[model samples]
Target: MTEQSEMYVLAIDQGTTSTRAVVVDHDGRIIATGQKEHEQIFPRSGWVEHDAKEIWKNTRTVVGKALVDAEINRHQLAAVGITNQRETAVVWDKSTGEPVYNAIVWQDTRTQKICDELAGEDGPDKYKDRAGLPLATYFAGPKVKWILDNVDGAREKAEAGELLMGTIDTWLLWNLTGGTDGGVHITDVTNASRTLLMNIDTLDWNEDIASDMGIPMSMLPEIRSSSEVYGKGRKRGLLIDTPIAGALGDQHAAMLGQACFEVGMGKNTYGTGNFLLVNTGDKPVHSDNGLLTTVAYKLGDAAPAYALEGSVAVTGSLVQWVRDNLGLITDAPQIEDLATQVDNSGGLFIVPAFSGLFAPHWRSDARGAMVGMTRFHNKSHIARAVLEATAFQSQEVVEAIEADAESVGVELTELKVDGGMVMNETLMQFQADILGVPVVRPEVIETTALGAAYAAGLAVGFWDGIEDIGRNWSEDKRWEPQMDEETRERYLRLWKKAVERTLDWMDDDVEELFR
Candidate 1:
């Protein structure tokens, strides 16, 4: 047996664009990491899919690569934590270990009609009171419905209790434990809360909601706390027999990794999208604003911590568009350098409603628009606009959070930031300037992976407690607001104008094409 000192925690982060395996030592530092990006399948203009088999294969590969890089075996691993892109639904056969269809990505907007039908009469907020989420295409429930309704034999298989439904976290968890054999099918409170099928208060699947969607109760994974010994790794895997203890949605994992355990503390993770979550403590704080009330995390046998989250659908992905779609920059990081060449966007405002706006304003009818473009505006100006778009979107969510938190007297003094986009100094500075608050970055930017490691380590007693996790957190750098109130207000006004131009752009004709 490996000594306690020699043991480490492993975190598998199955993200929107990639899968990553990270090894964390006792000091909360990442020792080794392996990452691989899977293909983003866009079958139509608004539909997004991922090959679940490919994701699973990548997961295995990364795990082995990380273990080999760290010069460790399965015996040295104390436990395994799984964090994933939340709300991406996968319905697989329980016996075959094969996905029924490609996994529906969270960003996919093909379920708009389903969402509309679900929102009939009562509108999108029909289930918001119970599920803490609007009936939007951004969630898993509608996506699951789309698959069952469209795919041949899917509904029959689901009703026959042969298919199992789960988000990316649940999918990874089942495969990691032992797919088609004895895999423990379960999801944490955080991930479950994102699905419209789960009752937010009870922390369980709402049978009424499932019945409404024509989904079988058997297809749902067992709900579990964020930290617990769910199961062990499969015999054939690199983490064979190691405890698979923790699972969380990527954003919630970032919250835990940022150590925002206290009520009123919050963190904003800039990734494929920007998710800003503010801890609202034990009892759920229902949002009057467009924010979603969600489970932050639930440690083993402990009451769940709740949060108010504002999700922006497009942030870093917009940068990807500028890189891949437009030939503005060769690399993602290079955009920062080009953006710095221009002091501002030169009156250009980009509303990246690429897949529609999320949080504060849930408008699926909206589409991407670049307003205030002039002949004088060059690639540098476009780069600046692209980076500023992320900041502006985040600001909108922060405002919504503040409004929702105000009733409870919870205020956000500062924001703890993380993710791939946080490395861009240009964007970080602009984020602070636009928010009018200091933005702090931690020494570990990949909080999503670290948070999962903390959960797994805690469940297996590799770490003492939440306080132990807190001690490991330290600030790497800080960005203070530099823009004056007058300038900030002016930029905000222009941005709002640009956003308005995007709305209702996907009108009747656009709806016809999708249908």
Candidate 2:
């Protein structure tokens, strides 16, 4: 048999916007890929939801499509891996395996009131130490608390151990492995960190934090390492006995995808949101700089490697807002062409803290705003400003990472780029120009899926080592800084001024809700 016929790895990437599957060969080349976008539910402002059934429907459809595209039997697959949007919460029945409600997505800010209340009454500082995360609406804990409190009989059922709570990964795993028919409910450490239920130290669901959040200890899923055979693959009519190995939050998986094994190596993924992660080796380096410490990834059952992460609630979504909301551009790709029309932003910067400013700032009252707009500014200038805003956000995150790393004596030199936004060469150059570092884009654009593939491949003996995976990776582009230091500094200063104006815009808007 040919190499293609011998072994293949299947990766399921459950992201913020879609569910996708990629079939990879032993050479690490993607032979089959299928993507399906699903609906986004908005019950109220800042609230987002996805039907768990819809997610599973998409997941099954893509896997079938990928298998067909590869023209291979399911038996050829040696193992399956999964990567997902972290912090998204879903609760389902243990016996019947059906969702109680729509999956509460990570971006949903409905729990903002709960977060505000926690942050005020001496709960923020206390939980931050225990969980290594702030009391934020962006995480899973508040969302879990929301469901337990607001939904009738939900809390009582959960406390009675009739329910199962999980992030997206666990939900997928449970369903894929024949839900309730010996189904497995397990989540990787990376996803667990975003839930605020897991103690970053012990890597287990903490009873103290669970008590504080008012979530029943019984509803939680078992936490597993990022890469290990957690269960079997049981896809209805087409069941494969491949080891269900590897799972992680999308961004953390991308860090491993970039082979950021050494300290100071980092990656910034630009998608619906932007996440910047810096590998800090074995030690879980606590952040004094308003950033979050999270599990990078785990190999087998060993302690999960750690990293510090900073999040921007909006990135490419801002461009989508202008196109989809303002009807400015025909498509998201038009943003690059439109932005290229302007030499500069004409003194405009957009702070898309649509939800809130995360990391380094941690200001929930900061709302989305466009600053320094003048009569000279048109859509082109606005487009340029939007792209530059993403870069400025990264600059802010890097500065925060620098400060935190300094407290622990680590210095970063470069960043690995991935996700949908990095496809624009113009944006990559502008990002490099602003940061004064060579921005490296890998030959593979879908590192999130690839990371999942690599993790699963490792477990099934299809791949040799992490070093082999790194060696197989190739670079497609390298962006170098071309801007003068003076110009860079001038833009940086103006960006800072713009950020200051955005900080407290929603203080009054959120007052009634927080009350």
The segments of candidate 1 whose C-alpha lies over 4 angstroms from its true place after superposition are 513-515
- Please name the candidate that would achieve the greatest TM-score relative to the true structure: 1
Native-to-model Cα distance after best TM-score fit, residue 403 in candidate 1, in Å? 1.4
lDDT of 2 by residue, 41-125 (tens): 8877677899989999999899988999988766788889999998999998898888888899888777877877766768565
RMSD of each: 1.0, 1.9
Clash total of candidate 1 = 0
Candidate 1 lDDT by residue in tens digits, 248-283 = 999999998999999889999999999999888898
lDDT of 1 at 220: 94
In Å, residue 242's CA in model 1 sits off its true spot by 0.4
Screening candidate 2 with a backbone cut-off below 3 angstroms (N, C-alpha, C), the clashing residue pairs are: none
How well does candidate 2 match the true structure in TM-score terms? 0.96
The lDDT for every candidate, in the order shown, is: 0.92, 0.86
